[model samples]
Target: MNSSFPRLVEAVTLCFMSLNESCPRTVYTLALRGPLYLLFAVIVILIVIGNLLVICIIIFSQHLHTSTNFLVLSLSVAGLLLGVVVMPFSMVRSLETCWYFGKVFCNFHSTVDIILCNTTVWHLTFISIDRYLAVCHPMEYQKQMTNRLCVAMIMSSWSLSSVFGFTITLLDPEIKRKETFHMNCFGGCFALHTKEIGVQYSIIFYFIPVSIIVTVYSRIFFVAVRQSKLIHSYNYNPKAPLKSKGFKATKTLAVVIGTFLVCWTPFFMCNIIDPIIDHSVPPLLYEVFMWLAYLNTMFNPIIYSFFYRWFRETSKNFWERLLNILI
Candidate 1:
C-alpha cells in the first residue's frame, strides 16, 4: 500500500512538471512573438530604405562630388554598412535576448560598430570646422581649402577612428567572455574601475569632437550675422532686391547643427548613463535611444536635400525616373 501511494504522488508531480514546461512556450508564442516580430520587421525596413536612398542619391549625382558631399558620402556608406551588417544582427539578438553569434563575430561586430559610429561623429566635427573657416575667413578658406586638403582630412578622420576602434577591440577579449552556453556578453567592463581608460576614450570620442563642433559653429554663426549686417548696409539699385545669402547660409548651418545635436545627444547620454545604472536599462529604452542615434544617418540626407538646391534637384530627377518606370 505504501509503495503504491508513493508512486501515485510521483506520477502526479511528473505531470505537473510537464505542464509547467509547456506553459511558457505557449505563452511566449501567443504574447511575445507577434508584436516583437512585427516591430523588428518595421525597423529593418525603415533602416534599409532610408540608407539606400542616401547611397543612391550620392552615387548618381556628379554635383555631389564637393568636399562636404564627400564626407556625407562616406557617412552614408558607413551608415548603410552599419544598418545592414550590425543592426539586423543586433535586432536578432534583442529578440532572443541572447548573443548567439559566438565570440569571433561578436568582436568583429563591436569593432566595426565603434569605428563607423565614431567616424560619423568626427566627420560632422570636421564639417563644422570647415564651415566655420569658410564663413569666418572666406579669403583664407578659398586659398587653403584645396581638394587635396579635403581628401587628406577625410583620410585622417577614418584613420583616427580605426585606431580608437581597434584599441577597444584589443581590450574586448579581456572584457567579454563566452558563457557556458556559448553566448558572448559584456562582462562588466564599464562597471569596474578603469577610470583612466574611460576618461581617455570619453575625451577622444566624445568631448573633443563635441567641443570642436560647438566652437566652430558658434564662430560661424557670429561671422554670418556680421556678414549679413554688412550686406544690408550696401547700397543697391532700387530695382534690385538685396539677396540674404549670408542669412540663408546661416540658417542652413543652424539646421545642420540642430540635427547633429538632436541625433547625437541621446547616444552620448546613454553612454554616460550606462555605467551609472546598477540594473540594466529596459531593452526597449535602450533600443529607442540607439535608433535615435542612428536617426542622424537618415536625417543627414534630408538636410542635404532641403538645404542644398542641387541635392533636391538630383533627388527629384532620380525619383521621377523611378516613377516613370513603375508607371
Candidate 2:
C-alpha cells in the first residue's frame, strides 16, 4: 500500500511540489515532448531572425522608405517584439503547462502579447487602406498618404493597442481570484473570458479588422484585374508606372493578409466559441491554436523574401557588405 501510494502521488504531480496552490502538471511521453520542444525552438529562432532582417533592410535601404514600406516596418517591429519579448516564455508555459515566472511577470507577458498581436492587426488594416488608395485612387494616393500621416497612423495603432492590452490584462478574472479547477490553478496562466467578453473581444479585435481588410482587398483585387486586362488589350504602355507599382505591392500584401487570416482565424473562432460552450475546449487544443497564430510572424518574412524583389536584393547586398567587413 505504501509503495502504491508513492506511485499515485508521483502520477499526480503539481507544478510546484511544495505549494498546494500550484496547478497540476501534465506529463507527455518522450517522443511527443522532444518534437514539440524542437518545433517551438525553431519557430522562436525563425521569428526573431526573420523580423530582425526585415527591420534592418527597411531601415538601411533609404530607397525603400515609402509610406507602404513604413507600415511594413511597423508590422515587422511588432513581430520582432513578439518574438523577443513574449514568445520564449510563452513557449515554456504552453509546453510545460505551468507559468514559472510568477503572477506579476505572467500579467506583463500577457499584456505585451496582446499589445504586439493587436498592433500587428492594426498595421495590416492600415496597410490595406494605404494599398486601397494607391491601387484604387493612384492620383490621390501620393498626396494623401504623406510621411507625417503615415507616422500618425503608426502611432495611433500602437496607442490603441496599448490601451486594449492594459485594459484587458487588468480585467483578467484570474487576477482577482484563484481557480478551483486544475487547469487554472495558481501556476497555470491564461485569460479567462466569459461568453459575453469573448464575443466582444473577438468582434472588436478579430472580426472588425478582418472585415475591413477583406472588403478593401476585394475591391483592390478586382480593380487590379480589370486594369491588367485593359493594359494588355491596349498593347501600348499607358502612364502606368504608379498603377503597376501599386498592383505589385497589393499582390504581395494580399498574400500577407491571406496568411494572417489562415493562421489566426481558427484561434479567434475557438476563442469565441469556447466560452460560449462553457470552456469545454481542451487546454492542449488552445495551446495548438495559439502556437499556430504565433507561427504567422515567422511566415511574414518568408513571404516577403519570396514576393518582393526589393527584399531579396537588399538582403543580398546587406550580407555582402557584412562579409566584406568580416574578411
The numbered model that scores best in TM-score is 2
Q: Give per-residue CA lDDT, model 2, range 87-124, as digits (tens).
A: 99998887677889988898899889988988888898
TM-scores for every predicted model: 0.76, 0.91
- Against the true structure, candidate 1 reaches a TM-score of 0.76
For candidate 1, write residues 130-193 as lDDT tens digits: 7876778778986777788788878887899899778877765333322321212231111111
Error of 2 at 121 (Å): 0.9
Worst 10 residues of 1 by lDDT: 6-15
What C-alpha lDDT, on a 0 to 100 scale, does residue 205 get in candidate 2?
Answer: 81
Please tell me which predicted candidate would have the highest lDDT against the true structure.
2
Indicate the residue-level lDDT of 166 in model 1.
Answer: 83
lDDT score for residue 147 of model 2: 97
After best superposition, candidate 1 residue 55: deviation in angstroms? 3.4
